[model samples]
Target: MRRLLWPAAVLVLLLALNVFFTPSFLAIQVRDGHLYGSLIDILRFGAPLILVALGMTLVIATGGIDLSVGSVVAISGALACLRISEDAGVLAAVAPALGLCLLLGAWNGFLVAGVGIQPIIATLILMVAGRGLAQLITGGQIITVNDEAYKMIGGGYWLTVPFGVLIVLAVLAITAFLTRRLALGMLIESVGGNAEASRLAGIRSRGIIVMVYAFAALCAGVAGLMISSNVSSADGNNAGLWIELDAILAVVIGGTSLAGGRFSLAGTVLGALIIQTLTTTVYSIGVPPETTLLFKALVVTAVCLIQSPSFRAKVFRRRGGTAPPAAVAEEKARVREEVPPDGVRS
Candidate 1:
């Protein structure tokens, strides 16, 4: 919880800025029995990112990365939309798409865990190959579907709340239970902390690594479905372009170590919300559309620096005109050694 303070503060600051720009930014009203507000929009649109980051958090905790998630997102949506366009039922289309995502995930896991490939390189292979695979599935075209049932997953409302938001909540709860309630979280952390030691301790580190990658892909797959379903189309070339970057950013912002070990799901969700809110802020504040990415990059960089403990320690030391504790202790020891028995300086 202490680790989350900085991120939470930053998110609040961003939201406050939005409130200043748009007075009604935080206002929520029920319209036709449906809740509507900027905050709601953020949650609805950011749902996919939240899911992707959740999976990335787990994989990162296990000392592995999955660069193929963006590609998996593209492939999942493309396959689902393509099947739907062929007059298949929504369930039929979604099931196969998710299954393929699982297979792709397992294949990535196999490469990294079984064949001993580096996680980045192993996933990167699929990252590049999967795009072509998605294009092939779509015949180099955007597949659009008119299935109302499918739309409900991403865009439709239920009980005055976005269904996508509900999905995120459900997924979050399940992930929490699996990792926290069960022994899975400890196992993942042990492997991440020291893979060789974990293996020696009979933890089956390889299997855990494979499982995390598979889980990451599964989350990406669900995100893909939500995106395509909301838009009612899947552009193989652009469905989930660069989403992995955002997911990684969210995980880092949420206080997850890229080096792997401990993770915080709540922090990841907050991080994702911060990012989505930042995007919304850009538009509301009237920043130039062309410069939006640059603006976002600058803010994110500042947030990261603020969250860095080393950076803060240096800043505080400079402001307080004090050296670090180690330096001060060393100086004290040197002075003590130099002093004579009379308790005076040499």
Candidate 2:
């Protein structure tokens, strides 16, 4: 319960701000009986961050980060848009695009895992260079496609639920299955908790590290497809600008430590939701655009402080809370208390 302090605090703050600034922010209204309003917009548009953060949870869990994901998003969107044609079959268009994404993923994996380069330094190469590659692919122009099947990746509806939301949910479900059903958590923890110890235990840490980066690239690809669908055009610059910050912010806000250890996918999902809601609230209420970034920064800092070791200890000691000796058990107990009944804790 205590482990969840920071994420819960962030969720509460996001909700409170929405309610105070935008009276109907939480109220999901219907226009002509179809879903409409601030809440829906938050859910629909925030799907991209949710997808990116899901991959980030895995990478950060292994004591690494992938800075090139934004670039991957751009490349994936560009490829998908460039290949869209009135004559191409659905599979012809989408499969090749996703294949390119997987190749990029493999490349990232090779650089980070095979070459023994630091995650940040390795991903940075792609981050700086991949955008230029994407622009070159598009001939430095935004490509708009009119393919119906491809357009549905982002703009289609699923039984009144947005396809974008469904895609995010599908990825979340798969991730949950891998982590929970397969006990992959133990493998990840072994690697992150102590790489030397895990290697001694015969766990292939390098492969796992590569897998994490590859998985991150895969996620960015999905996000790119969805984003381009929303706009009906592939604009590399605007598709996922500064979203790496948002992904990092979501992970931290969701209670996943940047230092890397145990992780919570559920918490990350909620963190993404909170971020979307905050942005929607800011826009709905017409707050000065200049203050929005400042406000978000302040909120992130506050959440991080709440999760910091010093503050946690201070609150725990002052409140006379005691933790069990086993580190894993202690963290789990702490997380439970921090998570609200209505909110997910990372």
- Cα-based lDDT for every prediction: 0.91, 0.77
Q: Measured by C-alpha RMSD in angstroms, how accurate is candidate 1? A: 7.3
The parts of candidate 1 lying over 4 Å away from their true place are: 323-346
Could you give candidate 2's per-residue lDDT for residues 25-118 as a string of tens digits?
6787556535776667777899989999999888888878888888888888887788774466656766776777777777777887788788
Task: Put down candidate 1 lDDT per residue, 174-274, tens digits, no spaces.
Answer: 99999999999999988877788789999999999888999999999999999999999998899889999999999999988787777899999999999
The TM-score obtained by model 2 is 0.87
Clash pairs detected, candidate 1: none
**For residue 21, what is the lDDT in candidate 1?**
89
Q: Residue 84 in model 1: shift from native, Å?
A: 0.8
Give me the runs in candidate 2 sitting further than 4 Å from their true place: 30-34, 312-346
Candidate 2 lDDT? 0.77
